[model samples]
Target: MSNQIIVTTGIYDAIKETLRRKKVSIHEEKRLATELRNARQVLRRDLPADIVTVERKVTLKDHTLDFEHEYIFVSSTREKLKKNKYSILSDIALAVVGYKVGDIIDWPFKGGNRKIEILKVEAWEE
Candidate 1:
């Protein structure tokens, strides 16, 4: 079961914001990216291997726009948990955007690979 990975602009903003608050230096961006990448690789390595698929869709409601994608979790590493643990899945989700369904993606980590999916998306004007 091959999963689909969804990436959106908002997720990028969140990562940037989080990193900014943490005072991640410009040089650290590469390192952070690498860590994120490594995390995904770790997940793939530690989790069960499966082929998950994904679908992307756009929605309009009440003058609002939203995007959503769905995929399946094949590996135990894909499972969502509340506790903050250092894992590929978690790293990818935090670093990358729209990580919902299941899709294999390459993270910037030194040499990291991730399987992620974009579960949902929503856009609103402030």
Candidate 2:
């Protein structure tokens, strides 16, 4: 009696395993890159810069909020008005009256600058 054995190498199995590992590594690298980019953006946005600071103490009934900070005003059209216009502080106060500190806001007018960060809010009268 003679014993005979048959063995074969699986090309498909090897390729599948290699592809699976590569896919996992690619996904991990992408996730890490996204996290790093997000951290950098947050740092850049929060850090203070050299600009004009306009501090305004806004009072509405009994509530008061101190808006003190420097901001950049970008407008496409800078037209001089015949009548005197509202100051930047007054415009910001009107836009952010009901908002609280640490809230992100966006106010878009015909031609206006957007203001962020209420800073501090207090309750007072007159």
Candidate 3:
């Protein structure tokens, strides 16, 4: 998709700072850089509430499995993948980051493609 991914200015800053100071693989650096280059940044107050942003608690349904799952989108420092806390830097989360409620996100995973429909997005209280 050619649509620009929207990122809150706060999130954008955090990601940018992380990229600057953290040591990561070239591939990861390229991915993060691409996100910044292609993003549309906005102030936190202007961020659409339905969209999945940092620290948002999101509920999604797997179209392939007919199963529901809940995850708290966090920074990589805080993610515990199996526990449903997804790092925004992860491939899965990155692919789905700008999605909003009712949006279908399709991404590659493991050995095949996976699809999930966003059911809800609860903005972070802090």
Predicted structure with the largest lDDT when compared to the true one: 3
| Predicted model with the maximum TM-score | 3
Ten contiguous residues minimizing lDDT sum, candidate 2: 1-10
Query: Which TM-score value belongs to model 1?
Result: 0.27
Per-residue alpha-carbon lDDT of candidate 2 for residues 19-84, written as tens digits (9 for 90 to 100) = 455532444334323322332121323322221112223322211233444222211132122322
What would the per-residue lDDT of candidate 3 be over residues 1-126, giving only the tens digit for each residue? 335668888777767776787644455566567867998988878889888887898888888778997878988888887778888766556556776788886655544567878888997543
The TM-scores, one per candidate, come to 0.27, 0.27, 0.68
Q: Which is better, 2 or 3, measured by lDDT?
A: 3
lDDT of 3: 0.74
Worst 10 residues of 3 by lDDT: 22-31
**CA shift of 93, model 1, Å:** 1.5
**How many Å off is the CA of 21 in candidate 1?**
3.5
Global lDDT for candidate 2? 0.30
Score residue 40 of candidate 2 by CA lDDT: 18
For model 1, residues 13-115, the per-residue Cα lDDT tens digits are 4445657676444544764554434333223223322312111121212111133332221123434334222222233334333332233334443234333
Q: Which stretches of candidate 1 lie over 4 Å from their true place?
A: 1-12, 22-90, 99-102, 109-126
